[model samples]
Target: MSLAELIDQPEFGHHESPRHQTRRVLLLGNDDRVLLAVARGLGRNGISVDVAWCDPDSPALKSQYVHAFHSVVPYSPHDDQWLDGLHRLVKQYDYDLVIPCNDYAVVPLQLEREKLDPDTHWYLINDDAFQVAFDKAKTSRVASELGINVPRECEITDADVRSGFSNREFSLPDRRSLRFPVYVKPRSSITASDVTNKRSAQRVDSPDALAEYLIHEFPHDGVLIQESFSGVGIGVEILAHQGKVLMQIQHQRLRETIDGGSTYRETIAELPELTEATRKLVQHLNYTGVGMFEFRYNRETGDWVFLEINARFWGSLPLAIAAKANFPFALYELLVKGQTNFHTNHTIGVRCRNLINDLRAFRHQKAEEFDLENLLFGKDYLDFYAPDDWRPQLATLVHFARSVLGKFTRRIGFSV
Candidate 1:
């Protein structure tokens, strides 16, 4: 039966549709790991999947399940170059949905959802809500309003940003109260107009360094200075629609970089307090799609502090899928089929690793850093490698070789 015919039937997601007719999906703006994880799940489920990305060397391109590849700009503010390409893809082909992978694409899609047909299953949100989730300052406000526990924060005002710190002077009233060694993060990941990359929060150890850091990043709006917490990283992965949460999964870091993103993690059923906080935050935003409410948790005499939110799919997506959460398929069913086949419970203590990054982190352990021992060997559901889909294994090696060569050649003063 034709896809249109099959979809119109009452039992689309049911077992009746054999060789399920084309339900074309486009995965865009997600990083390599997330893209591969999502693509593999949906493709295996009889969806015709295409990948559109800005990076040529992305590992997702080598996935055996991908039907086709296209190059597209990640985001554009003043022009429709990126938007136009996306429009053509959806219009030319009756794509079931376009899943945005990261903030770079989510920001633009949220800003221009009307052009993309607001009624479609584009996995988008209104710009106002995006601000609350994407902007740290706004997230703090909303989290606090929801009575979710969040870290102590200090705001950087417009007047402070307007007064250039190049002269090494900017007014910070909270500086006296703030304990040294705090985190200074851009209010939003897309700090600059260009949206070049997902911005990183840095640790500034002292007042002079903090001033210098702000001076360097002067023009970007609303940089947040927050109290740093030393604790284990926790992620509450959730999927919601119109303020109703569908499914929630929890994972805690086994090994993580000093900044963010865990290289090695295992699904864990942690505190119920965090679960309550996550549900409140998602419902408060009336969040309309998949999101990860990231937190930092202290063991004793403290609880989960709302760190930030990933308004899209997260890097540890593979781990979630391995735990049988299957977020990609769940999201697809919710958007395309108009109903979610919920996985009532996700497996706990299922460890997953990004082998490459884990090894890199171990190789270059910094001074006074947590040692990574016996982590290099792991058979527990590798992130980039699948037993059936082994193409990424070769593609990843070639890409890594090129990256290392480029770095080495640059040291000798030449671009590879």
Candidate 2:
């Protein structure tokens, strides 16, 4: 059956018939690339997409895919006030699904589930699951419990801060036998925010440097200190419904924006290790939602060590779509149609190029190692620049133009 025919069945839950249900998704965080990709994907499936954002003049507001736009003051999703606004919005229009694009929104949205209509679906990993997913320390504990291979780590909380240069400090941990080049990062943080709640990490070669960094930088709200693993990065994206994994795909990172972050990037090819770990994690969590599991292929053991799971839809979704596992459509089926015949094994050979980071990766590669063909025409990763639709694409173009003009006008002493 055609995808539309499958989704239109009575068992899928839309009594309004296919045409009426086609355009009924409400998307939060309108500016997020994942939301845009999700919206575009849903729109393609005959779903009408509406957007709400703190920034009304968001470039997304102009998208033809978006049916209506709501202006909201930027507020942390963690706050109760944001939930109140969401409740009011829900009362006015029954949004079939609520998708949070950033990490900061994941926890609060999950916790405040009671405020939403019972019939309205949200695809976040459960609250307890999210606590583990968002916090590195908690994730390490859970992985150990689940027998998943991961790094050994400890969390340094605000209480860990101690006074003076005393040898009897309560905050210090015995690091005599721990491996050198240990990695440190925040145990918890909100979206696009400061890296350190109060403390930062400097890779320490000696015990004194570790002690000094902990004493100085991590007088902390939250931070994680763990053994560093060397490996090729791989990501597995999946969709779960009723706690069952419905679709899965794995992709290797050919480039990254940060040393260990997914700010922007592209894919190389599907990695077997990443695909397996993604399945293992979703099974362990008994999770129901759109999730991505990241793994670092440890060179030391020649195995992929579980890193952390994004308990919500992720940033590189377009790449996943281009690579042949369209998670957004799978999610729409679950939320709108409640369909379960959701299995696929499509793969797109993706390569993200022209992005600032991908450009850097290209420059880093030696001439003989570089393949110039994929750079010109996308071999794998989806570039926001390439669009199947003209309206949202034009909207993005105008938005980018205004951004450049705003910067130029500021340089010329004009107030924006």
Candidate 3:
């Protein structure tokens, strides 16, 4: 019997034949803005969308768009329970499609893909494409090969770190090519087996700092150390089918924290150079899904460096919908309706802000980063609010209140 058969037997779910029903999709993720965005997008479009994640946030589960919420084991390459649960869920409910919302779901779906039903539709990329896209060093090399300018980067491979591990001596052999301040990032966002691998990239200034980071991180597979530049982060989002670009848009980060996507962003007209390079990159990957190619563009010099790619539905997905790009809807239509014609017209100068994250970002920003006029006027989208769907927003309020109250009480207790 195949590994898939052992993972999903008739005893688990196959025995019960699920009667065919309306198109339904299983979204694999935790409490992410993209999950809520995709859920609401698909649900409002007459497709039943269900939420499945490990240790789901309570407030996010209150979304009215969700048909059901299933908590399952988190995927670690060493474990089969999560995969088993997915197989059981798919077989029992007969999900028409499955979409991964974030890296946790994306990595697992790729590694354990064979254990799931091949005939069933899954929105994931091949391992080859994932390696090139997920690894910053590889991403830079590929971008350079395609005539796209990229920041100088060196990977601290296992070979580079073995001496450090064995004799406390480690350094990049070709470190002279890259300048400081340099940024260190795990080659892949997550490991196949390690659940606690979403370590943020760090900007290091000195050799001591780099060595300290290596001592602490112990990047087993490798870490990409790249030259850092001063510029704004720009996201070039695209939806492609079989390597053909369908539609694309670009957004500029207005207010951001160091580690994650911007809490405040505004859609702008696509830069021609970046868009052309992105098209080439997509065709090179033979990409079949919607993803964002991140870059940092310097206005002063008309220069840009390839950052990385989020090759799945990302944090700013709601912004895409607000701009009329509607990636989730496009994905569903592409697969379910066999529709390929997508109009690439997107409204520019639209801003999106996750109120909660924006509020936090505001606390950490300099005066220049905050935009007063755009905050008050222009096309804007608050990440978690819709007139029709007020329940999730309400849940967010409740959760926020509790969190504040808990923090205050803890402070008081400590003082007393």
Q: lDDT by residue for model 1 over 358-407, one digit each (tens)?
A: 76765565425433343444447778888777666556766677689998
Best by lDDT: 3
Q: For model 1, name the residue pairs that clash.
A: none
- Per-residue error for 14 in candidate 3, Å, reads 21
Q: Rank by TM-score, highest first.
A: 3, 1, 2
Number of clashes found in candidate 3: 0
Q: Please provide TM-scores, in order, for all candidate models, with all chains considered together.
A: 0.86, 0.77, 0.89
10 residues in a row with least lDDT, candidate 1: 9-18
What would the per-residue lDDT of candidate 2 be over residues 48-137, giving only the tens digit for each residue? 776665255443444445566665444454456755676666656666777766554555566566765676566566766676787777
Sorting all predicted structures by lDDT, with the top scorer first, yields 3, 1, 2
Model number with the top TM-score: 3
TM-score of 3: 0.89
